[model samples]
Target: MKASRDDDPRVGLDGRLSWRPAGAADLDAWAALIARTAAVERPVWFERREDLAQILESRKNPTAGNSVLGFDVQGVARAYGRITKNPDGEKALGFGCVDPAWQGTGVGSGLLGWTEARTRQRFAADAATRAAARLRLFTEQQHTHHSALFEGRGYRIVRYYSEMHRPLDGTLPEPILDDGFELVPFGPELYEAVRQAHNDAFRDHWGSEPRDQEAWAFVVNDPLARPDLSAVVVERAGGKVAGYQLASHDAQSAESRGFTEGYTELLGVRPEFRGRGIARALLANAMRRFAAAGMDKAALDVDSENPTGALALYLKMGYVAVNSSMAWDREF
Candidate 1:
């Protein structure tokens, strides 16, 4: 089946529905669909209206690597998704929601097929780097249907992870900064140190790979990176370098998307600092920030089998397992 063109409506299954590239003109409809979809799948982490708008803006910018598409029935969108190729050109596609009003109408398959085609066109079109083309996404393990959809589309699970959360309504834990260790706010100045710490911290973990400094800089510099919510480290007594905790707010935006929950982007403690409660301290600090921001709940996705005891730590901190997802891939 041919994909829809930039100027054409995508006609699907018996011509009962159509899809097209989602644009600024479709913002209101897009927001409404997203809100309704989230309401139906409460507690799921989907993109916010503002984030969607930002994504649209990036797609229009051409130079930016974000692209989105929508499935419509007669002129109303019932399903939608996006493909985001980061600065490094690594690509991933995230999609969902069948309008309840149109679950098995072939809209879902069409959207998935189109998005995959676009992903291939974007990355595999270049002969010099076609082999580097890879598309990946995460789905809640509880989302059996959605997981099945991806599997049907030829995607395979590569790793498993969990979403964990903790509440901050009770007494705060006293943070212990080992002699010569101190907690600090992450800022532009600590970019290299933070990246170095992350590489060192996760080096031995399965699938862990060193990140390029420039790409790390772009991530930390992105407006959506949330500097205020990010955590870092310095020395104590005299101030040096130790470890870090990278957190961000998705719950606030999740509110706009019709939910409430914050996300812990990355939580890492230097190798030498493990077992000293530094990770817990960083988490407490993050929870404090979440509460201060008026969030009633917070969450983080973790490798379910992290060799470092991260998952157990989250459980001990009040983070009950709500949903789980796995990373899937196949030799390509």
Candidate 2:
């Protein structure tokens, strides 16, 4: 069905539901809805309420070219859908949540439908630069209902991604590194280098768009970004990005959800530095950093089908497959 716009009661069934931009005033209530919904559904990853608030505040800024649509009834936000425009100008809809108490009342569908229409309209106006309009979204594999909802609205699964974990208590093998190339703390100076290495490594992979300087800087400066948990480069005598790793404590939400595990979010090695033990060295560096930070264990996810042999390398670094998620795609 074609989505409706323009202050029409058609935004939802009856005149009870309406759509509007999300604002700071709605974050507390929205987050409460998320917490309650997650407690009954899948894993609860968000811990700090303030952290979630900060993220929501960032999303509210339209200058970033991102938007949040909320379904409000009698002045209460019951559901929301957010779309963030990636560097490629593709709208990646993420983090949609609705109050479970209102699930079957048409709230979700309304929020989703409105967001899609707005996204399609916005992208359509930019046809001169990019002929094809792209709208992509992802959900956990266990979210059968979510996938069904998207598929019902013409969004097809495009790629399957898996989330895997390994126990840090297990004995780990030593990592061999090139002489004089040792793990260093991540700092302002190395942010660009790390970004470059990751961009280079992911250049040909699926959806391999690299983040711009501002995006990378936000990460390096984020309160959630822990320098101690990161491993970085110092020298590249062989003309490669010697090594890199990014590890961090569970985000406030994750920690509050009772998960204290650390995470290795990114690890990269330049092509010229591959096979010389740089990757393994970086992995070990991340693990040790987490261990020293008093975290009993650490975990990192990798694409099982990563073209860079990441899965095998992670396994060699004492990681074992714990859980899996898949990406699915169908053309519109």
Candidate 3:
């Protein structure tokens, strides 16, 4: 399919819908549309309005120009698409969804076309900076329709990720810090330090780019962030972060799903600190904190092929795989 022109606001939905770049004013409608799509496509989790707002407001994301929303004749949002480039500019990630009622109606295909064209424009604008680039889209394993759509467009599965959960009601492991290291409560003072440590830790991980201050702050300061449940491992002598685990609780999800869950949003251990049990210790510490906070379960997602053997560690830590997703990429 040919991508729509960058300057075009119409997505060729057979004139069934009007299209425009999504803005702050569309947060409520956009979130409602996402919730509806999630109920059918990925029922396990959904982003809240606040979460959507952050993405739209992030300084690193050109949301105004890169995100589009399609509305029906009644002015109800029916489809959405967004493209965001990584800090390194080597890859652009695509996110979008169509109302379940609108599936198979060509709305999704048109959204993808717009995002593809926008991604190409972005890369072309920065051709001097990057010699090669790619566009990636993610879909759950159960969403065969989405996979078919991507495959039909020449995208190929490049990686898989597992979403794991462990009941906090069971016996929890005790975190044992390695010699010369200690676990401390996460605080605003350690934000920069943890950011640096995280970037260093995931440097070799697939598709990971260093998080700039704006992006790092967005995660650490998210409304749902639970600093009380997060921990930072530091060297006793120098107090430099060696490993870290950040967590969040979605009250809205708990209310809807009938169970409280503490999500491990980010976890990492610097390569120099690997094999010293820091990663395991951080996870165990967070699990205990979640249980102490009256959470019913601890949840996290991990790259299936993590070089650090993180998936094995989580499995051993009693985290059972609940669902999985695949990443598909079209390289340019």
Candidate 4:
């Protein structure tokens, strides 16, 4: 049923649907739509209402363009899309999802079209600062329909990522550290150093972005973050952080799947310190901590083509790819 003209958000030009800008109060509606979509088995990160709220908060930074357009039918919010302008060399846009109830209603097309237009407008505003801008978005590989949708609009699959999981039986390979290195738990004070080390560790990585304090706090300080479960390895020789693993929880998702899981949100070992067993030590310590905390499993996602053999290492450590997602891209 269509809503009264005055009560509806801006109507679809054809009078088939309606939409309006969203705010924090729309969290539950967004979460409801997301829950409907996540019911499908796929390699995708789960998002709770709090997660969506935090992401919206992250958009407060000037560089990350944030827009949430709630799509509705008869005054009820049933679908929505959020596009965030990310670190610019690639000119990335955040993920978008629609309600299954509106699949054939042109909602998806309208949303993607808006994302591209919004991205272009944002990059144009800072044109003098941008160089070689390319637009990109990520979607689940199993969603062949979505893959077809992007490809139909000139996007190409640029990368493949795997959602990997490991049972937390407290049997992760023991972290083996060299004589001059030691594992240290991260404290709030090391926020800056950790951010710096993240950039250094991922400088050679594909799609890596530099993070400022705002970005760091937005992700690392999320509600599920357990600073105690995270581990940092420092070279005792000069007290420099060689590697680190930041852990978080997806309690809702885990419980939904019948086990509690801890996430290795970010894990990296600086290039100069790669072969010293720093990464292994960090992983082992984090995994042990999660298991000790009574988590039934541990998880992380990896780029399938990672040059560092991260996927192979995770497999070696008994983690298995539970799902795969593809990165799609097109030049702006």
Candidate 5:
């Protein structure tokens, strides 16, 4: 979509600004725009060309259903927004931001309203989905301006997720699984079980969404996914999956932040097997492996109010909160 006038419902394009659909060629410019916004807005997070490329690549379905828009002022890109659906198509998710210089202008709101409308359009494409669809956005809890924006726009805080890290320099205790359970590296034979384990583990988690095979496969097949680093537990009694953790890292992030680290992307213990130290053992094993790989630190994110007491467990394992963020949601 292209617009250069104030009457555009999707976005209020001020006279000097132009709105254009983002394309592959915009990857570098998009990275620069997002980097500038993050540097001033959420400094704890880092962005790379890969991140923007990933975004553009994810929503390349050739429709407004999943698209990004770049806002240019005087022929220079200064803002951007994107909207896409979750795997289940029950939610329309995206975010928008303006350069620091344009922060106080109406640009951010314009982009937000526009992105939300696109997401709604995605839902409206089908009556069955439109009736169940929702619009969601995210921002760090500490970024009060963002929270204010979401709240003013009728969004609510649905959950709090925190990232933590612990140094790997010191010796750590050996991992111990349940009496009949054993820790093993992920393999093709256990792929199906891994899917069941993750879904069952987070079935009751707040804001948890069920992931199908395609979604699950994407994570497993990502170039950065390390099957050797991932953890999976098998109960010896009946040979069922108990818990698992995904270990992956971004080369760009490691270089940008100047550190060697292994991130525990997803950790979950089956509901029937909760409170049995399964999660702890998996985490310890991951830490040990990361240290063996010469990683200086290990990191993970946990819900602040997880029913499984994961935050306490991570803290007990010497991890400290390095950043905090929340999931903001809206229904329309």
Candidate 6:
């Protein structure tokens, strides 16, 4: 399913640049290109090599023919783009970047155009997605150039997200659960239960769709995932999973950023269990666990318009907004 170079959009953009489907051999170069591009905008987080590898090899969203890499004459990757259709067939997520040195040479535009075309091909190939499908991209609010690029292509901002951080130096709140609910450490045995709880909890969230078992496994089994730091709240009466806090630590990012931090990757409480202090308890427990693990801070991202009022809860927990990003969408 490799794309022929003759039809590549990068052909005229730069005579010395060649475009091809990215594969296992391009992992290192692709990661290096991503790091360089991210530095220009000072993103709040960085993607590790393992993270990129997992994405490239994911089972549910395979990148076999849905990704492209633009390499220089010297054989170094200078740009990359990938599109993945969600399992539910409602949207296609796109990610791409061009090296800072190659930014103005039309590389970014070529990569974006290719990604959009790929997205359309993917949607048309699937009967379920062709009727109501969209292509979504995310960029930090400060990246004005990125915004302009997407906007020029008929994309519009659909949602905003805030990255919040909280220092673990001060006294932390006690994880006080209600009488019927108790906090338990995350483990493999509770994986399915927690996954079900997560799906139910986020059913009403914007742009959220159910995660099949394969996708859920990929998340909980990630290399950076920290089971010891994660916590799940269960109802003692029926042993029902009421809430969960999934945490992860990236040593590479910590070292590069000069600060150790634990990321609360996903946190959710079942609708029926809301307002019973389950969410707060799960968060407090995660914060204390992170501090106990010697992390200097804890961080998480929340949609600015989350229906559950998560932003207000994070702010009340001493997390301050440090950065912001926007989700842009273009319908097919």
Best by TM-score: 3
lDDT of 5 by residue, 1-332 (tens): 77444434455544346767777777677778878877667554554566555444443234333555555645667877777665445777776667888877877787787777776666766555635557878777678888888899998888888889999999886798768899888888888998988989888887777777766766786656778888898898888999998888765566556787888888989988887889889999999999998888999888888988888899999999988898888887
What is candidate 3's lDDT per residue for 26-127, written digit by digit as tens? 999999999898877755666668888888777767678888888998999999988888545678899988999999988888888887877776777774
Worst 10 residues of 2 by lDDT: 59-68
Ranking by lDDT: 3, 6, 5, 4, 1, 2
The residue pairs in collision within model 3 are none
- The alpha-carbon deviation from the true structure for residue 153 of candidate 2, after best TM-score superposition, in angstroms, is 2.4
Q: Give the top-scoring candidate (lDDT).
A: 3
Q: Across residues 1-332, which tens digit of lDDT does each residue of candidate 2 receive?
A: 66446533225432454655555676676667677677655642442355445555452225123434345555665666666555355444445677677776766777666556556555655554363545566677777777778788877766666555655565655655767676667877777878888887777666656777766755665556677788776564643456688876754545444555667777777766677777777777666667667665667767656787887877766677666554533221
TM-scores of the models, in the given order?
Answer: 0.75, 0.83, 0.94, 0.88, 0.85, 0.93
Worst 10 residues of 5 by lDDT: 56-65
For TM-score, candidate 2 versus 5, the one ahead is 5
lDDT of each residue in 243-272, candidate 6, tens digit only: 999999888777567899899999999999
TM-score quality measure for candidate 4:
0.88
Write candidate 1's Cα lDDT for 27-46 as tens digits. Answer: 78777787777666654555
In candidate 2, stretches whose alpha carbon ends up further than 4 angstroms from where it belongs are: 1-15, 44-66, 69-74, 127-131, 236-240, 251-259, 328-332
Q: Candidate 3, 280: how far from true, in Å?
A: 1.3
Q: How far is 331's C-alpha from truth in model 1 (Å)?
A: 5.2
**Candidate 4 weakest ten by summed lDDT:** 6-15
Off by over 4 Å in 6: 1-15
